[model samples]
Target: MSVKPGAADTSAAVTTASWLPLIVVVLTQIQASFAVNALTVSMAGITTDLDTPATSVGTAITAGTFAMAAFILLGAKIGARYGTRLVFQIAVAIHGLAMAAVALSQSPAMLFVAQAASGAVIALIAPALTVFIATNFSGDQQAKAIGYLAAAIPAAGVLALLIAGSFATTIGWRYSFALVVALAVVNLVLSFRVKPVPPQKDITIDWAGAAIAAVAVILLSFGFSGLNSWGVILATDAAPFSVIGVSPAAILIVLGTICAQGFFQWTRSRKAQNKPQLFNLDVLKTGAERATTICMATMMFVGTAANFLIPLYMQIIQGRSSLQTSFSIIPYTLSIFIASTVVARLYKTYSPRLIARAGFVVVAAGLILLAFTIRGDWHQIFVVIGLITLGLGQGAIVALVFNTLLTAAPKELAGDVGAWRGLVHNMSGSVGIAVASVFAVGILGTLVSSQLIDNPTIPASLKVESGINLDQVNFVPNDQLVVTLENTSATQAQIDEAIRINTEARLRALRTSLLVLAGLSLLAIIPAGRMPNEVPALEEPQPTKGKK
Candidate 1:
């Protein structure tokens, strides 16, 4: 296969490009997104059908994200060796097959397998996509192309929600994944129209660096994921084992940080030897690039955390249906799509640091507003307003940071940008969901005891007699909660009072969690200001041979 002509001429490539290939790349993003989002709407269905706990579904999500994050760098190297377009096509095919498997999954274990398979395929797609875009377009055209793809990402999630809502009612949740397969097939056919991208035979995978990066990211993700089940500070009863009653989650994070440092050292050594690096360490050498990277991860973390928390509160706590969850999120998702599509026009009008700092402010403001407005009813207008604010900010940040990183490096290092982005995105998303979920749960547990102690309806004698375990507090629907109270020796008035206490505590926990996240978002403004103030030069700024 031959690479299309004038691939090195970014400006010329943009002027002469066809839109079909770009559309194909965007479709690939939608395909992968559909697979990732299938579980969000089907959480209750899967948990019920497989007779498994909710944690099992979270485990599947984590497994998939972890697999993708761990293997992405190697996937980029492989893509370079074999040709990006070919690797992308093959990955799409595998992703389709994985989606089909998910459709027929009969157990939680099988579901995890399906998710992991899809995840591994997604790792390859990242690098391939980066190379494809780099080879095809540049300058403002590249920014617009990336913006459209980013917009499509949320559209995919919206589509997944609708598919699940429609099919889960008529047939079952299994049909939801079947829709993912259908999209993947359409995308696969369109991808063949993309021009050939040839292999970079000189590039090779570094197995040692790969191992270190993989293990480090996996451990960091695992640590975060464990917080909900294994306890935040100490080993909970769910934990299989512990070291001095300390949380295994904490231990893993410490180990992961050390490994990350080792990875950097190894990359430096590889560079000094004149070997190509797994990640483009050259790009990361600057303070601006590093800040941009952190801001990118932080933006994703907020979005992921908010998404997880919202769906959970609606579907699990309020006992609302999947369709209700979809409807509730419509404003936010739509706002994001609109913002992502339109914000590319602002590139020339504003500096990156200014745009990024403003984005963080908008997001933080949204979080605070939401914190103050949440009620048992999940009010429509206020929630919509708050989410729209958050979405507008999120969309701008994602688009700007993406263009910034890609522009900072040479076109040939597009795969490097892609691989690192995949790692950061998946890792941050997993950690965000895990941290928010467990942190809220921990806060709820603490508040439940205090609430029971303060409630006038529950006398000290009744607290001992009812045998209610405040330490094991968790959010459940009112109906399930009634069943739980039935097992305890309590009068009707006392039961109602206890349920009210639990509900109030849960609401309080949500508020507190949002405030914490908002504070974190506010903290990010400092680094957002450190991002490069202008677009980088198009000329190759990488180190020359033997420079290290």
Candidate 2:
């Protein structure tokens, strides 16, 4: 039986009342999506205000992502037992309160705690929304509905960044959290329309699996998050004011791996005893399922890394205002929407594999172009390359991952698979941002050490005003400090001169990261080639006996 009670009836028409519920679900989903953007925007603000290191701020994001992934199965169980409508209400409420607290937080610890609560709430809401859609609509309607609904995430991201930049500039970053509270209010009011599903009687909740998964995800995410820290980047040489410690990240990674293996064993043991397991091992053994999961993770890792790094480069290095940087990325945001809409149409006529491959090729070609053409004289070339390639890749990624994952999974296991898909996508995004930040930091440090320019004296007032330690400023290394100085109230002549030198090094770092992404993208080509010309897995729903 499908998880949702009435979702598999393809021949039935949606009632007028049904539309309101669907709209409510979409609105609720947008709150979590808004968090994705809010977190990214606030990364800089938190680091600046709390006197926390940039890498530490970055880690908090990864921690939240880890929490979200680890708790998704638990969220699914909550939905199955307590029902979707109630679970969504609780999720929405918890998330809103957390956002409010985050806005008030004065320290990194407080921010991390707030993020953890928000992550838990996100896990509860995301998968339940998917199940609600699946159980409500079936057949082609289901596919089309999900495609449009899924687009809300990126759309919310764009909206959040736009609002955050403007509000932060005028009223301060705290006011940006007020935006989420307002959205939550709308979501709460609209949630009245979400019709309740009857709770399942035989549903099994796997507390053991949930605990293990949480530990594993937190450990793994923490490890990856540490990649952005100085401890890992410069292990041997102690630079000025650099963080010194054993590899806390590495230890967490090892612990996470162990937890994962243990969790798998526990699930298998439950199945062996003829008890219900949280996940169906049999469903995951298929090649298509495995391939689809891998592809989703890879795509998210690359795409998210690019998104995080590009904004940092523009706002921090290029001395663009946050608003200007947001506008610069407007090309990326619009390209995703435009290409996704067009590709949805094209997928009906052409093999998705072929279309997806074309997108990958365009992305690789564009990145390669940027690598070679990045110079002061050729800045426009980089913009053009980013626009064309990023558009193609974003469109292709959404269609390929969403469709393929859904098509490959068994109909009965759709909710479980959807939960896993969301988990993978978010986890990869977290890691991608972490890994990319690490490389960026390392590159900046190297640039600083080369001593190609006259190093400016560390501003005493600036450190005091920002409430950060002088040692933290010293740890910035040469290259990044130059870029930071260029963006500040420095003389225009000095800023221009710093820009010339900093641009060259920044281009080098950006190109190297893009090359790595290009290589990861090539892995998708083979998997895409193997996809069936037609999606045979998705058949018309069998008619219910009474209806016929």
Candidate 3:
């Protein structure tokens, strides 16, 4: 591979350096992971403390994720223009301050602001990690480093579940964010030891492309995340505004998709003009690269949807405590951690196409198993096995696709590749949770409305008298439902019937949603088959005139 003229030569230093830089990179990954996971594990406490609905927390998560996806392309360019090491240090410090804000948050709005700030900074850190690895490691060592970086996500999740769960249950949710602040500080202090590459003065930030990308991502993120609350196609009462009676969510999605096409067209124009592009389109020029992106997005969609559904089922439907929910998820998180760390060993023995195809198959089977085996009980052995199976597949694909992208791209384009990967992960994850919620709640609403009409116990007259709107139905615990009915003229028998209907509808909705995800997983096998038959060799750097 031809290296740009101004690119630093650190091959000799990289080969002789110790693993300290990798350690710093891994810690940085962990800090970001911990912030998100801690919020997830402490959902109950957050809702209670802030006196807000669960959807508010979901909004906060989406805001942060959307912010990251929106700005990551620009972030990659920023790292190249301003030294990656310096940018990384600043981002880490800012992230720590954001965590502190989260710890001190007095309301849901404060939490959202803090999390969004953290995510924007993470855009800088995410690309830098990949650049660091590409700059500091080579050959097998680089492969191993990517694997470790991938594993850190689930590993941090495990730690968050254990530590945050305990804190939320025993003390307060604020402690978890406090812990993240401390980790950020440690990462900052250790970052000074990492090798630094000189900034590329020739690279120019593409402000127009960045604006298009940011607007497109923001629209798509809000559109998907608001499907349930705002209405899939029609405007709901909860929708802040609408377009000619159509939901803003639907309109936003269409606009966002159009803007996305505009972004690509803009990039092409910039390339034609011989100007610095927002990202190197060549990073995704090949069929294999496109396929890898699809596979990565699909894996994240399935994993994140399952992750959202499981916790909702345990905590909301079953009324399990936060700590108990964390315990139930332990097997799944641990499986991911173990699989991510070890899957690198399989690259030499098996083709990536084969492994990726098998991984998707396993993921589909796991979802199907969970869909069928889930009962009122969350402690069933089959449930545990299903979770583990899903995690293993997700972990393997996560590491596999990332390593493939990095190895295939020239080192000069490493930051672009990383930015693309981060964009996929965040955008897909947000869409996954949104789609899952829409499916589960929409299905539940339909089933409940139909059951109310069919069940002899729930009279049509009662339904009319109760003033309940079928279209606006939401998933609530039985106890909460009972409390709601207490205000009405509902008799004991009517209330019991409503609870029974809710119980059955929730389970059926979950099963149907899982089946839908399983079908999506099976479809992903098409792209998985298109991945490189074997891992691609890293390109050796050769000097050339600087051309971004």
The alpha-carbon lDDT assigned to residue 111 of candidate 3 equals: 93
Error of 2 at 438 (Å): 3.9
Q: Which stretches of candidate 1 lie over 4 Å from their true place?
A: 1-16, 43-58, 106-109, 454-456, 537-548
Better of 1 and 3 by lDDT: 3
TM-score of each: 0.90, 0.79, 0.91
Over 270-313, each residue of candidate 3 has an lDDT whose tens digit, in order, gives 99999889989999999998999999999999999999898888
Candidates in order have lDDT scores of 0.82, 0.67, 0.89
Scanning candidate 2 in windows of ten residues, the lowest lDDT window is: 468-477
Compute the lDDT of residue 375 as modeled in candidate 2. 44
Winning candidate number (TM-score): 3
Clashes per candidate (backbone, < 3 Å): 0, 3, 0
Q: Give the alpha carbon lDDT tens digit for every residue of 1-548 in model 2.
A: 22122223344543322456567666766677777667767666768888999777656665676678888877877777777777878888888888888788898898888888888888888877777666666555555556566667767768877877666666777777777877787887777666666676587788878888778887787667665552454432332233354556656667888998998899999999988777667546767556656666777887788787676656555666566677777767766666654555554455556766677777667556655655433258566566557756766667566766665565556557667777788778878888887776566546634534334533344334434332222222235655666555566565455456456566667767777777777767777665445543345545555653
lDDT assessment of candidate 3: 0.89
lDDT of 1 by residue, 1-548 (tens): 11122233343222345678788888888888877777867887888889999889888987888889999988988898888888888999999899888888888899899999898889999888878878777666777887887788899888888887667666888888887788788888888888878898988789899999999998888888888888778888888678999989888888898899999999999899988778769667789889999999999998899888877778866778767878888889988898888877776666778888998899888888888888877775787798899899888888878878888777777888889888888888888988899888889989888877767877877766656667767777777777866777778998888778777887788889888888988899999989887655443223344644
- Best of the candidates, lDDT: 3
RMSD (Cα, Å) of model 3: 5.3
Give the CA lDDT, 0 to 100, for residue 466 in model 3: 71
